[model samples]
Target: MCHMTACSLLSYIAIAWMKMVPMQTIRSRVQFFKISALSLVFCVSVVFGNISLRFLPVSFNQAVGATTPFFTAVFAYLMTLEREAWLTCLTLVPVVAGVIIASGGEPSFNLFGFIMCISATAARALKTVLQGILLSSEGEKLNSMNLLLYMAPMAVVFLRPATLIMEENVVGITLALARDDIKIIWYLLFNSALAYFVNLTNFLVTKHTSALTLQVLGNAKGAVAVVVSILIFRNPVSVTGMLGYTLTVFGVILYSEAKKRSK
Candidate 1:
């Protein structure tokens, strides 16, 4: 949360110096409220997502996280009343199937971790759906960067109290971690920079495409991450799991083609 807020502040400074900040104004209280609410959801999702990782293997987490696209499609339809192509809907079948299959092969499962991961995944999808509605509504659209500039501060406001209540010796812990390894500071700075890019690109994509597309892309990203994990850890993969991952990639390709045809 601190990293996100820092990036937002840095973005604000960069835009201000560029003299482009004025163009990224919030037009109304309603819009401000909407952004704040979305940011709160984002905060919850991130908190739970990190917590879940402690109990679940990365592979299982990714498998569960792959359900975001399914939830996004459902929320987009229900919340935004956005109709998607039937083919696009059909394409998600294999995506979910593959993930479920892959998850079934997981060596361990914690009910708590599964629940938290699923909650995080659902909250993430809800965030995307809400963002799509908020950004696509009437009047001038908020600049992608500006939205982050505003939302990030609001997220920090919501996160601060929660952090104090839930975490122990936050400042001392951070200082201790940094003192133990100065490289940790550099890693954090690097992560913050990448996170800023992720937020900026996410907003841009959500503004241009439907939320479901972003969710689908997120699943593909998960698949890629899984492959990277296997390579990094030198873990042996089962044939069933490999086929499941392969099917997910194939489904993503099919979904992309269906989306183009729908357009």
Candidate 2:
């Protein structure tokens, strides 16, 4: 929470320093409401994502997140009446089945983690869809930096209360951070900078492509994360789980190819 807040603060400063244009791009009531709603969804999604990490093994968490493409497709279709290609739809089959199989076999599975991850995934999909819709209009589109400048502060506002209510070790964390070397502070600042860049890129992607595309990209990234987890964490995996993960990666690739052909 603190890190996110810091990132938002820095982004605002950076935007101002770069003279990124007027901060009044969110000009109308409807735009304000839409941006606010997206911010709230973003806050919940990120909070749940971090919370779920506490209870889930990194491997399982990434596996579940691979399902984001499925949720993205559903939300995009429902929200914008955007129809996916039949082949793309069919590819979702293995994407979902693979996640289920892998999750079922996960040794570190916790029901709470499973639920939180699913909720986060859904919220993330909704956020993506909203960003795509709200930012698609050329006349109303805010540049990626401006979008983040607005949305990040809103996210901080939305998340602060949750942080105060849910975080019990605030004082302990503060003291620990205080006692830590200055290097830790630099690391945190570096991480916050990276987070800002991530937010910028995410908004740019949603602005440039449909939410479904972003979600598909997420699946590919999730596949890479899964591989990294397996390598770094040495997670024990069942044969079924391995097959499931493999299926998911290939299915995502196929989905991307199918979407391109359809386009």
Candidate 3:
């Protein structure tokens, strides 16, 4: 949770820096609102994603996140009226199955955790769809930097209150930072920089790739993050989980090939 919060703060700072650069193109209030709303969805998703992480192992969390392509397809279908091929639909089955298998037999299900994961996935899907629409309509007017700038500060509206009320020790940390916790300050600074990079990558990826493809790649990210966490944080990794990750990677590669051929 702390990691997620730190990431969020970093993302916001990145967005703010992007927004500072003046752009010749102008957006209407409605378009700006849409972008802002999308940012809010992103913020909410990260929060829920973090919360879900507490109940499930990091491996499980990433496995579930591997289903992002499935959610992205759903959202794209609903929002853009984009219809995926039957083959594409079929591809998700193995991916989802792999996630279930990776979860190590659902070790004592937590309803809230499951819900949070689903919410995060849904939010990510929605963001993809909405962003696609916005970019298609107004992309020429908005560079990635401008988009980040507008989005970063707007996210603060949601992040600030939530962090203040929900995060117990956040206030103390903030005070300590003010009082000269150089390490904490450094941590926060580094996190903020990482957040910006992630956000930038997200925008670039979404702009260049299909939403479904981007989401599919997101699975790989989850798997990698999980592996890193396991090695660094000493998180448990079961045999089934390893097998599941392998399957997911294979399925994602197959799906990517299919997408490329169709294109």
Candidate 4:
């Protein structure tokens, strides 16, 4: 929670430093409400994502994360009334099935963690869809930096109450941790930087491409994470688990190709 708050704070400061969006314009009632809704969805995704990682191995988390494209496609169509090609929809079959197969073989899988991961994935998809819907218009559209400027402060506001309710003595504990190990502070600073950049790039990419395209790229990220995590963490991954992960990657590739040809 502290790390996420730092990330949100960093986002606001960086955007404010850049002067990407006028602070005054952010007060428009309708725009503020829409962006706030988007921020809430995004915060839910981030929170659940963190919770899932605490219980699930990174490899398993990424494997399940590979299902993002499936959810993205579903939400995109529902929200936009934009039907995809039949082949593209069909491709999601294996993408979803692969996760189920991987779940069965995941040694470290916790049911609660699995639920949280799925919720996170779904919320992420919803966020992407909502971003496109609410902010894609000529009148409302803001560039990536400006979008982050508006959304990040709202994320910080939304996260504050949750952090207080959940953390018990978060400030004291964090201060103690920082006091005990200066390295922890640096680690958090590093992660907060990564989070801010990750979000900015996600918005930039989504602005340039469709929501599904971002998730397709994320599919490759999941595959890479699986490989790197296995190498670094030496996770006890089963053959079935690897196969499921492989299947999910293949499905993402197929889905991407189908969408391209449809275009």
- Give each model a TM-score: 0.90, 0.91, 0.83, 0.88
Q: If both were scored by lDDT, which would come out higher, candidate 1 or candidate 2?
A: 2
Candidate 1 lands at a TM-score of: 0.90
What does candidate 1's lDDT look like per residue over 1-263, in tens digits? Answer: 66677767778886887765664778888888899889999998998998898887776677778778888989888987888889989998987888777666665667788789989998999999988877777783676777788888888888888788889798898889999998888887888888888888898899998788888888778888887877776655677777777777778888889999999
Which scores higher on TM-score, 2 or 3? 2
Worst 10 residues of 1 by lDDT: 102-111
Tell me the tens digit of each residue's lDDT in model 3 across 1-263. 34434445554454455554454344577877887888789888988998997887676777778888888898888777898887778778888888778765555446789789878988988887777776566443465656665676677766777787778787687877768756776776677777777777777788787778778888778778877877876766667777887787777887877786777
Model 4 segments more than 4 A misplaced: 1-17, 20-24
lDDT tens readout by residue for model 4, 1-263: 44456656765676567665654356368777888899999889988998998999999999898888888988987878877778988998898898989999888879999999999999999898878765576666666766776677778888888788867898898789999888987887788878778877888788788888888888888899999998999979988888898889889888888888988
Poorly placed runs, candidate 3 (over 4 Å): 1-26, 138-141, 174-181
Point out where model 1 deviates above 4 Å: 233-240
Worst 10-residue lDDT window, candidate 2: 17-26
Per-prediction RMSD in angstroms? 2.1, 2.0, 3.8, 2.4
| Model 3 residue 168 distance off true place after TM-score fit, in angstroms | 3.4
lDDT of each: 0.82, 0.83, 0.74, 0.83
Pairs that clash in candidate 1: none
Among residues 3 or more apart in sequence or in different chains, the pairs in candidate 3 whose N, CA or C atoms overlap within 3 Å are 10-192, 19-149
Root mean square deviation (Cα) for candidate 2: 2.0
Best candidate according to TM-score:
2
Measured with C-alpha atoms, the lDDT of residue 4 in candidate 3 is 39
